[model samples]
Target: MSRRSSKIEFVGSQGVPLVARLDLPEGTPWAYAVFAPCFTCGKDWLAAARICRGLAERGIAVLSVDFTGIGESGGDFADSTFSSDVDDLVRAADHLRENFAAPSLLIGHSLGGAAVLAAAHRIPETAAVATIGAPAEPEHVVHTFGGRREEIERNGEAEVSLGGRVLHIRREFLDDISAQPQAERIRRLRHALLVLHSPSDETVGVENAQRILDAAGHPKSFVAIDGADHLLTDRADARYVATLLAAWAGRYARGSVPAGPA
Candidate 1:
């Protein structure tokens, strides 16, 4: 494994500051990628860091950030919505553009996958979009608001525990997600896309991958990681994702990064 240099930045967005990790190769400028983890996930999560390390090993820079309420970022998760999540992505991208080269790839996992799809057009330099165990619709996460819909509306917020972690869900967040037509946006996505899913994925059904694939236009590809779970926890599974991303990205990514300061 190659050594990676990492830094933390505090970015302002939606009236709050977000914490993000910028991971890059030492003393080298490489193609850059903006990677977003799943709901309630942080940049240091097992999958996110692994992907960053993998990309960096190939001379690619990766910016992995925690959203408003997740990880070390500020703001309340309950106060955040799908739209707000996209805002965070834009902020991260802009930050990288100023200090590093424009991003050549936009990678998201699960819900983050959906986000990258929505934000692709805004980040024109992106060569490709990739998703892992991503859902087909933005509203698909609405199920998380179950039983608390009334409370969130009546009290303005509801506490829900997911993945063994407790998070507050605000009505605004629910409204934003419900208003998004993710499937339609995905169909119109103009970038080359690689949809990766596992048949054994229990979190988001494998059918979601089909929905995304079917809706997408040409220059699209789908790969099934036969036995891997949604998170791609196994070393082999994560490595496979890295290999595939490197190969696909090479075809469309922009020029190599400028060499780091001598």
Candidate 2:
């Protein structure tokens, strides 16, 4: 299979120019998908790049976005919130709908999983949603702030370091996450849902998988990303996730074989 990727930019919900990597197969794709990366991670993060490109090679075009203030996108981290993230996801889906085909599948990693669950309602064309090592609620991300959680709470905003990058975290972000009704969103999510979590994932924890599954309605499924890390840093593990996702999403696509390995 001939697969390629190109950088694309679009206006985000906040009107900032957000960057994305659109991975495409050689010819017209039967289906398309949008990917939301882990919090603070860029589009080229190992897991994001591999999984999107892997999907492209399998005949499914994938648009992997670097949300506001992250990666090549333009915005201030301290000013971004959970609600903005969800809006950005909807904007990404809008881009796909206007330029190519509406994405039939939506996938997320880490806190982004929560974003997709909440944004699905805004994108009516989305037929399926999948998340990798996602938290059941947006508020769960507060734990990652560690001692800085107090600093942000007391001062309203604080600069924090993540993955070797220093960024600002504002109190509004905390408050916004707390206000999100993620569980209710999952319960009402009309699309088929797939939850992929690593039983050994030290970051998000496996219990979250159960929490999401229990809240979601029919056509929900859970798959253990056995022996995988939170980021799916291992090539083998990411490949497995991509393979499974392409196959699962194929059932929703109008026409096309399940995208298997090239």
TM-score for each of the candidates: 0.92, 0.96
Best candidate, lDDT: 2
lDDT of 1: 0.82
lDDT of each: 0.82, 0.88
Q: Per-residue lDDT for 17-41 in model 1, tens only?
A: 8888777766574578899899888
Q: How would you encode candidate 2's per-residue C-alpha lDDT over 140-240 as one tens digit per residue?
A: 98888779999999999998888788899998998899999888988898889999999999999999999999999989888899999998899999999
Listed per model in order, the count of residue pairs whose N, CA or C atoms clash below 3 Å is 1, 0
Task: Give me the runs in candidate 2 sitting further than 4 Å from their true place.
Answer: 255-262
Instruction: Enumerate residue pairs that collide in model 2.
Output: none
Which model scores highest in TM-score? 2
The alpha-carbon lDDT assigned to residue 138 of candidate 1 equals: 77
